[model samples]
Target: MHDAATPSRSQPITAGVLTALVGFTSSFAVVLAGLTAVGASPAQAASGLLVLCVAQALGMLWMSRRHRIPLSLAWSTPGAALLAGTGVPDGGWPAAVGAFVVVGLLILLTALWPHLGDLIAMIPAPIAQAMLAGVLLSLCLAPVRAVVDDPWVIAPVILTWLALVRFAPRLAVPAAFVVALVVIVIWTAGHGGPTGDWLPRIEGTVPAFEVGALIGIALPLYVVTMASQNVPGVAVMASYGYQVPWRETMTVTGLGTVAGAFAGGHAVNLAAITAAISAGPDAGPDPKRRWIAAETAAWSYLVLAVASVALTTLAVSGPPGVVETVAGLALLGTLGASLSAAVSATEGREAAVVTFVVAASGVSVAGIGAAFWALVAGLVTAAVLRRR
Candidate 1:
């Protein structure tokens, strides 16, 4: 009964489904790898994933409901990468839990203080856009990289994506995801793809605070989550002309992070890459209707939270880059838009370029990632060249 003038269900359906698929496929492995590296057994890692997914779903629901924007929330992927490299704290996973609690408290502090959110919001628009481009640079390369490594599996997927984009833009990412999923299932049928349990195995640990974990894990995790994830997340929304209320975004995620830690989840923050996906025109031709896409994403996140065990099993068992390739392809449009925004204003062009390069470099100092430095570099460049 739907005509061309009437909205296609595909818009919301694809937006929601892609949001969930991208959330799971892209960085779930990085999170799992991080948890395991921190001395979490299999059960503990799965538990962490489940709790984080649920936490993110809750944050998304709250934010989207209050603000009416497609504001997506996610666990800190860079923070997880940090944990993977940061040696296990002295008291093991329990110590890590305690560190998570500390991070939650710090996040809460900013949420309660309007000025803190304002401080983050005050970051120049071009630099913010550049930082976003930098953060997403590596993940956006997966589609091409996959062609080099596994062209047969990836070629059909990308082809389908390209065709859909040309003729059926709304369904592009979702269709690509379906294609990728089928190929993974068929190829991994007996190939020993990452195989294991996919059941919600809740592993509870009493938090044990350690000074070492606080300084090494908690502080750095807090910084990275704030700078790399939350800050850029705000930027992505701004790029699309949506003004997200930073206070609500921070308060909900901060509290959610605190609650999720008992269940072994880590820092929860605003999503940077996926936000662009949901907030963009692909979610819907009409910007007003895009919030529906975020609402759909919230529902999908909750569903995935319940199915975290199964999703984890599939993620670990997939062909090495299958998930990442899909993630990159899905995000290509957003990346292009971000690049355009970064370079659009000649006034801040030089600063934005420095920000993009440094942020893309993935350089870290004292365990802090480059997103913050990218902002700093861009700001300094702007300041130094102000007279020119």
Candidate 2:
């Protein structure tokens, strides 16, 4: 078993900053996309996302210290989208919150029954990777579309980001986003755009209990959060050699989701792509020290959640083209790697293909989202074709 002393040299400040920034920025986009799709006013959606970011960051810190592992939590992107598409219509934010609490409890229960974790482990790595790639493909495309619609706004940002990533890898991700934001602000100001309502404004709603709401919103939310977000997130951590207890991690994620829901945040879970940053060598070569960084991220998230409404609004109301482009560019590397790994795994190509296609197709049934369906399809296909 690893101990904190093992990573004594890894400084908390740098690791925490990087982890928080990556988590906040990457997940924030998906939150906005979900909100926009659901017809949430820009301000309301932004506030909700900020609450999520804060909760995830805090959860990451608490769990990392408690488990002595670099565990990071995040809002489930696919789950958020699923909620946007189906959840709001069923019972709105209240039902979504109820679902989050239930899921958290379920995750905690899984700790007592290791079989659930074992069941998740049975999923083939390649297929899991393929599902991740499919989920991220749309995110990668956002920047390109943004550029086409507003080349003057997005082109320079992308170009500058690419150049920096190639030459100054450390600054590439954050710098690109910051630069784009600055440019956007200047452009908006020049055009006499609205600035008074730039930041997110808080508007809290109390959750109400309803069985139908639970069925329509909660169950599906739990299913997608586990299948699409948590499953792949665990895989990413494993790939980086972090042998954390799956049950505990899930439990914490569930708890974070519960906390976030009270504050209007949607589903929170383990992060897949962004988790790679801290899990890998970038966080630190020493495994133990990385926990410190993770702790810091969690603390930062808590603080952010406390101030969610404002930060989220700023992110949302800001220049859309710039933010979307920066987000896509930041994820470019992770997306490429995930896709390659998915297709390359032995005995997994067909399964991976099935997962990718289904997830990308954006189809849902009985309120269940595409991620769950993708895994089902891939597994079924793999089983059927095995005898051939």
Candidate 3:
């Protein structure tokens, strides 16, 4: 006889599938844009996307089954936004790859070194969120520009996203992506159909370290991924009565990021928003059974990996600003949340505002990007204000 606690099989599975759909469809364009901004070609960017999926899938599956916790993993969407804002470093793509590797190593260090983790935690929350908001500011403007530049192509996607957000908030971004995909299809058909090599493959890069890339890209990426994704992910799961295996979780994600970096991927970390779907009551009445939702999402990510090449082709070949509109729309929620958190507290509001302005300026000094400078500026301001 089935255990009395066991509920219907489909509930967890459906939640798992929805988790994957929302996670992938919502922010992939941002990933592609980030990789490209940091010097990846279309092929390399596609490879990065493929490897990120495979790596996170493998990590999530192992961790969820090992701990029997609903542990979902994801590529760092905030880190991607940081990249989109950072532009290319001194040594270009290889330098960017090297920066990615450094981020992974830093994550590993965080797991092994308690002090390192504590140091990250010591960073003022307002400053960190302000930095992320600054990084995302420019990308969030894409939809507005698209509406002005190509209203006909962008109007339907914006309308779809708005409609779904009202009734089905979780599906809003994915629905926008669907509309964008349909627009791409129609645009492609008119432009003589899709054209490109559609077979998914990993394009390897030999990482080359440079001081500018490390300080500019690696430091900010690590901070954003930790502050925005990993830390919040743990808290989200904890609210559901699950204590994530911190060491094991970090070890797995760190290793996964390291492995994916060689294949042109950026970073992978714990899921924030999507974790609630897999860990929440909707997955099942019994908390023990919720891990299945994570497992299911992992498998779903693998399936999506196969379509990396096709999706990359469509995004690249689509009408100008159309895919960007989708990417921008996808980040709006994140930007709003970050901005709210940044300015919500009066204690550090001045420091946080300074961070946001410096980051949004997109300034580079001594070859380092605004993200790093923004953090430095915020911390200094906070320290000065506290002293006064």
Candidate 4:
């Protein structure tokens, strides 16, 4: 009984390009941080990144084909940061991979269990939105903090970005990146030294798995990836009116994580904030066309994963400031929008605020970060208040 109409393929190339661009712009920094935190050498980290990107792309492809939905997959940015901040340590890759396999299996299992999907479905919308907003707030603050450290470096880019966003929304993020990169290039050219070497280098590393590493790294990674990233990712899809099967999507994400982990990539999951772009009207009116974009993203990711080692090297060798600035700027709009939505949702404004505060607090309990606690707290608050 599925719709017989095949999704349009006309915009495959465009979809691939945009997905990759967004990946590069938003994820490189967190990916680097995760690899290095786990004691990966520059070369090893690059290889891992390549694997991660590939896993993400492949997962998207599989999901799109199976459900005929444009569901894109991505590495967990917050998960990467968690690994880096908590120090995943050396010899942890195998454990991490093991954890991925387990999570994926769980997702697949959930797909067969309608009760589990219904349970997740029961979670209130406001609380979910609050958790997402809180998790992303720190990412938003990075660019602003960058300004304080190097106003001369970040000011013009921020100002230019603000102007473009106000006057020409479509051009805002990419334009700001171009302008910032040019400025940085000119400045570095004039001020020689490490600045002269403003590009990532190519390198590779063989992945090694260890039980101890998994115990130390994988569990924490899984919890954060699921709580902070996947939960919100699913919520974002729902928010945009995508009524795709959550169980299937969960399975896809789980498999993607496992595949990426084996390939030396970190956690992969549904993208919450960025998912809005392709899911919205901009992708196309026909539901099928939007699914095409998701399919294209998957194929594009596979290509990237195969070339991850090389790509990671290049990213590392590239000017760090430029990439960070570009990514931060690209996410600015998304951050603002999410914040607005979280606040505007009826009946959950206070819960959302609480969730935001808890998530932004940067507190960690028993290895879990603020995002998890924020959701828990917000849900509890909402429940208690509802009774009154």
Q: Could you list the CA RMSD of all candidates, in the order they appear?
A: 5.7, 5.2, 1.7, 6.2
Q: What would the per-residue lDDT of candidate 1 be over residues 10-32, giving only the tens digit for each residue? A: 68557866877776655665677
82-156 per-residue lDDT for model 4 (tens digits): 455434434454444454466555555556775654565576655655665565566566677788878887788
Clashing pairs in 2: 7-289, 54-301, 54-305, 57-298, 58-298, 61-298, 200-313
lDDT of 2 by residue, 1-388 (tens): 2577445455555677677776665445556666555435566576667667766776776778777877877777666545433424445555555655676666665667868656666777666667666766776788889888888878888888889878987567667766766676677677665443444455455666556545545554565567667777889889977876776676667676776666566677887766776677767767766777677777777666555554444455556666667656765775687688889766768888998888777665665556567777888888877877
Ordered from best to worst TM-score, the candidate numbers read 3, 2, 4, 1
Q: What is the Cα-based lDDT of residue 274 in candidate 3?
A: 96
lDDT of 3 by residue, 1-388 (tens): 4765445577789889889888999999899989999999888999999999999999989998888999999999999989999998899999999999999999999889868888989999999999999999999999999899989999999999999999998889999999999999999999988776599888999999999999999999999999999999999999999998888888899999999999998999999999999999889888999999999999999999999888998888888888778888889999999999999989999999999999999999988999999999999999999999
- The C-alpha local distance difference test score for the whole of candidate 3 amounts to 0.93
How many clashes does each candidate structure show, in the order listed?
4, 7, 0, 10
C-alpha lDDT score of every prediction, in listed order: 0.77, 0.67, 0.93, 0.63
Poorest 10 consecutive residues of model 3 by lDDT? 1-10
How close is every model to the real structure, measured as TM-score? 0.68, 0.76, 0.97, 0.69
Residue 212 error for model 2, in Å? 11
- Cα shift from native, residue 116, model 1 (Å): 0.5
- Best candidate according to lDDT: 3
lDDT of 3 at 301: 96
